[model samples]
Target: MILDVILDALLDTAKLIPFLFLTYLVMEYLEHKTKNKSKQIMQKSGHFGPLIGGVAGAFPQCGFSAAAASLYSGGVISAGTLLAIFLSTSDEMLPIFISESVAAGTILRILGLKVVLGAVSGSAIDVLWRFGGKKRREREEHNHIHREHHEKDIHDLCESEHCHCENGSIIKSAFLHTLQITVFIFLISLVIGFCVELVGSDKIGYFISTKPVVGVFLAALVGLIPNCASSVVITQLYLTGILGAGQMMAGLLVGAGVGILVLCRTNKGVKENLGLIGILYGTGVFWGILIEMLGIVL
Candidate 1:
């Protein structure tokens, strides 16, 4: 069993590494080329900001989440856009699923649903906030100023040489990041596979598939963990048939890589971060239940 698990993980890793490396390389190159233009593009996206953010966030990397947080802090992007990025961010799941040989149709369906959910939820939040009266806006404005000053302080503390990465080669950075993620994924996959073997697929499925409401709640909470580890766990479970489509959706939707952590670190106060967490959790659970009701099976 141990040997089988190890071999399976190695095979999956082999399938993913090339794609992962190439994707990151392209992303890094694009980011380096468009760093300045991105801010202007995001600013001008306006009402379509959430859609644009959601699409960009679909890339299987946490870097976009951090970038989105920075843009939000700098007031270059709206709260809606930031949330959209958070909602749509899948961390390493996309690459893992593709590597696992999951059906392309299913992958597309899941991706489409996530992007739609992100756009709709983000737009709704923005609309609701608009009519939420002046007091909240005033407080938010105060927080924004504080966030800027706090960011400035952090920037001042860092040496100028360390602050800029313009001279760094995107290919080198992409290769490093890809290698890091691949190692992490392989380790997690081996552990998860071994555990699944011990626990039995039916037993695990019974836990999550029997009571979807509780499953979704638990899965969403797990997804809130601020690392790619959560994504690995969720994806492994789903691929093993331990989690149903609804449960998988709930967990993956809420698993926004390090987006929440970035929000907490960059935002002015705890209240805002807490609220965003609540929003993400609530949205994930709601959609999970809705999908369950629709009887969408993976």
Candidate 2:
């Protein structure tokens, strides 16, 4: 069982390489080439970030949430946008649904719901941030950094990731960065996989399935695992009639496809990270409970 867990973890981490590499490639290009225009646009379109993040994160790709974490750490995007991406990220849910031969319409509905909720939750966070005036200092700092030495800002991010490839060719830099994060992700996935194996998914499913009221909270907790297995377990439970739509979504919404892992490692400040996690957990539970109360079947 342990060996199988290791192998499966490796295999799952391997699947993320292409998307991760491509995301880094795009980041490199933006940093090296379109830094000016992209910065201008990113700032100008800041208000729409959550909406855009929701759309991008809802795609089948696994790296948007990870990339969003890096962007947020660099102060390139707001926390609301990061939360939006995390909430909407589908991780392994779509692939599992397709493999299980689930109805296409149902899949679409779930994806759509996630995207909408992601945007709504993100926008709300942003509003609260601005209303509380907590966003002023960060925005000013980001602007000052950009006005004086933008390249250093980008390099600072590279330093955070410990890639130090900022001075190299864009392709080389991107590759090194990708490899660094991929290794970190692999280690995390391996540990989580081994733990899950020990605890046993069957036992987990039975517990949550039997207790509907408590399941939302527990399901959201499961979603916070920061691995694909969270989605796999949640989806499997729902398909087996052990979890309803809202309960499955609670897990899925919190399953940000390793985004949480990246966020914790790359982003600074433990308290801030904890706060974001709290917000994300609250959002998932609120939506799940609301959906259940509405008796909305998907």
- Root-mean-square deviation of each candidate, in angstroms? 6.9, 4.1
lDDT of 2 by residue, 1-298 (tens): 8788889878877877777677667767878888777778777988999999999999875678888887777566788899999999998888889999999999999999999999999999988966755455567687774433232245566877677676688889878877887899999899999898888999888777766658988899999998888888999999888898779888888888788887787776688789899999999999998887788899
Clashes of each: 0, 0
lDDT of 1 by residue, 1-298 (tens): 7888888777755555665566556545546676556556655776898888888888887667766764564455777888888888888889898899999998888888888889888888777655663565578798874433232222221122142334568777656645655676567667756766787645544555556678988778777766565677778888887777888889888887655654665456577678778988998899888887898976
The true-versus-predicted C-alpha distance at residue 42 of model 2, in Å, is 0.4
- Estimate the TM-score for candidate 2: 0.88
Per-model lDDT: 0.70, 0.83
State the displacement of the C-alpha of residue 221, model 2, in Å, after optimal TM-score superposition.
0.2
Query: What TM-score would every model get versus the actual structure?
Result: 0.65, 0.88
